[model samples]
Each structure stands twice: as structure tokens, then as C-alpha cells.
Target chain A: NAGVTQTPKFRILKIGQSMTLQCAQDMNHNYMYWYRQDPGMGLKLIYYSVGAGITDKGEVPNGYNVSRSTTEDFPLRLELAAPSQTSVYFCASSYSGARGSSGNTIYFGEGSWLTVV
Target chain B: AQRVTQPEKLLSVFKGAPVELKCNYSYSGSPELFWYVQYSRQRLQLLLRHISRESIKGFTADLNKGETSFHLKKPFAQEEDSAMYYCALSGRGGDDKIIFGKGTRLHILP
Candidate 1:
């Protein structure tokens, strides 16, 4: 399977511009997440969803928004993009929470590198 | 707040030498710890979990509750083992939200 798929492997947005990072999973995962990876730093959670229509904030959710409208899709929206948002964004999914019922397996899509100028 | 700490940013070891990556976590309750690795240009993937007490790719990690540490070790390092490693922590039960360390870039010298 394609597993988790992310779009626009690379993008450069002008300051104040808006864009969306699309993510999808064919495994019918109930949990989805968005994370940003900065150079020399760990991946920071931006937003995550437990299931459809359920979204929660993560450590760094200031400039990002996410919606899990369907089990297969969780798209991250960037409004009024800023330079600080420049980083490699990763989208991941799991059947359940990492240590929860389903299992501790998380499948990740190829990261999307965003640069804000 | 849950936190995962990896003190080293880069670690270089000669081929066939022993290697260890240190990780410490701060959590009040029983936690689920994990090791994630990313090879050059490859997607990040799980290496092992503390709960399973299993070994992967000749690497193993033992979770020490008293010390709040889970260090990944390999008796003999290989060039293929060179990659970025991250230690992670998650809340008990199914709270998929995990906290990750800054990550350590491992370099296996030939």
C-alpha cells in the first residue's frame, strides 16, 4: 500500500501567504498527526486528531490548523505564513494511539519541506 | 509535562566499535518509551519499544525506570547504522501524543 501519502514534497511560500499540506492514509487509521522538524531539533507536534472530527493542539500549533474530516484525510493549513514556519513537516497515522489498544506502530509519509520567504 | 532528552547532537564511532545513544525522560506515571530512526533521505520509522524488550538490527535498549533512561546500544557498529536517532515518550493508555527528543545524528566511521 501507499501507506500514508503527503503532497507537495517541497514548497516556498511568501510571507503572509496561505497554503495547505495535504495528508492521507489508506490504512483506515483513526489517528493522524502533523509535526514539524527543525534543523538540529526534534520533531515538534503541530496538531493531531484522534478520529474524524476530533482535533487537538500540540506543542507547537501557533501557526497551523488541522481538520480530520474523514478517516483517510488530515490536512494541515497554514494561514498567514511566517518565516518561523520554515521546516520539514511530517504527517503520520496509526490505527490507535502509540501505546494504546491498536498498537504502537506509526506510519509516516514522506515529509513536506516548506520555506517561507 | 512529558519530555525526552538526548544530550548529544552528533556521535561518531569507528566501524566495529561499540555505540550507545543516551536518552532520559521525565514523566510521573508509567510511560511508553520508543526509539525512532531515520536513514539518509528515508522516512522516520520505529526502531524498538521499551515494552517489547526486543532487539532490532543488532541494537537494543533497556528501559531503566529508576534512572528514567532508555539507551540504545550496539556492540559492533556498522556503516548502515549511521542515521539520525530520536528517543520518544508517550502517555499511558492510548494517548498517541508522544514527546520526542532533539535527536542525535550517528556517524559510523569506516
Candidate 2:
């Protein structure tokens, strides 16, 4: 099964343009997240959803929006793209539970590279 | 505020040599720590966690509460071990979101 799938592996957008980064998971996980990684920087949480119909903002949620309509899909939308938005975006999913000894291992997609010019 | 830090931006070692990637974190309460690795052209995946207290792929990490460090170590570096490693932390209460460090790029010379 495809653990997690992200579309538009690479995209280039002009300033002020808007686009959606699609994410889907087949694991039926209850938690999904969107993160962006900049050069020499760690992944910063953009948005997250605990379950369908529930979403919340994370550390770096500015200029982004997310909606969890179903168990399989959680997409991130950029209202107005800027140079600051250029980075590698990753979609991840994890099961919500007691988090065993290994803790919750979040599965990530291959990542979507977005370049805003 | 909760934060994770990977001091080294890049680390290089020869095959069969021991390696260590330094990581330090700051959190007031008990925190869950994790190590995530990204191989060439692949998605980032979990390597190990402090809670597991187990080794994976010949690599191990120990959390030192006094020093607030969770450094990753491997006895013998392998060519296949070359990758980017990130240190992350999760808070016990409040928002259970994970925070990651800048990451260290480890390169093993064959």
C-alpha cells in the first residue's frame, strides 16, 4: 500500500500565485501534518489535522491553510506564494495511540519542491 | 519554548571509523526524542528514538537528561550510512507536535 502520496513533485510559481499541495495516505492514520524545510533548516510544521474535519495551525502556518475532509486526504493551500514560501514541503501521517517505546514513527512522502519566483 | 539543535552541519568519516552526530535540546518538561534520517532521493524516515532504547542499522542514541543531549553514534561507519540526520523532540503535554533540528549531513568515505 502506498503509505503516503504527494502530488506535484516539482512546481514553479510566480509571486502572488496560489496553489494546493495534495497529500493522501492509505494507512488510515488519524494524524496528518504538513511541514516545510528550508535550506539549512529543519522541518517546520505548517498545519496539521488530528482527524477528518479537524485541523490546527502549527509553528509556521502563515500563508497556508489545510482541510481534512476524509481519512485519506489532507491538502495544504497557499493563498499567496512568496519567495519565502520556496522550500521542500513534506506530508506525513501517523497513528494516534499511546506511542510505544519507539514513539510514533511518522511516515513522510517523497516531498514536493516548490520554487516561487 | 521547546527546541532541538544539531550542532554539526556536516560530518565526514572513513569506513570502519566510529561516528557521532551531536544533538542538544531544550525543554522544561519530559520530552520524547527521535532521530530521523533521509537517504539519497528518499523520504525522511525514523532511525531510532530515546524511548525505544534500541539500536537500528548499527546506530544508537542515548539521551542524557542532565546535559539535555541525544547524540547518535555508530561503531563502524558504512558507505550506505551517508545521509542527512535530524534530531527531533516532542512535548509531553499541550500540543503533541514534533520539533526538528537543522539536521547533520553525514558522509562516509569508502
After TM-score superposition, what is the CA distance of residue B24 in candidate 2 from its true location, in Å? 1.7
Each model's total of backbone clashes: 0, 0
Q: How high is the lDDT of residue A73 in model 2?
A: 99
TM-scores of the candidates, chain A only: 0.94, 0.94
* Candidate number achieving the greatest lDDT relative to the actual structure: 2
Q: Write one digit per residue (lDDT tens) for candidate 1, span B1-110.
A: 78899999999999999999999999989888889999887789999988888899999999999999999999999999999999988776656566789899999999
- Cα lDDT computed for each candidate against the true fold: 0.89, 0.90
Q: Would you list the clashing residue pairs of candidate 1?
A: none
Q: Identify the leading candidate in terms of TM-score.
A: 1
Q: Estimated TM-score per prediction?
A: 0.91, 0.87
Q: Please write out the lDDT profile of model 2 over residues A1-117, one tens digit for every residue.
A: 789999999999999999999999998888899999886556778899988999998889999999999999999999889999999999998776547654566889999999999
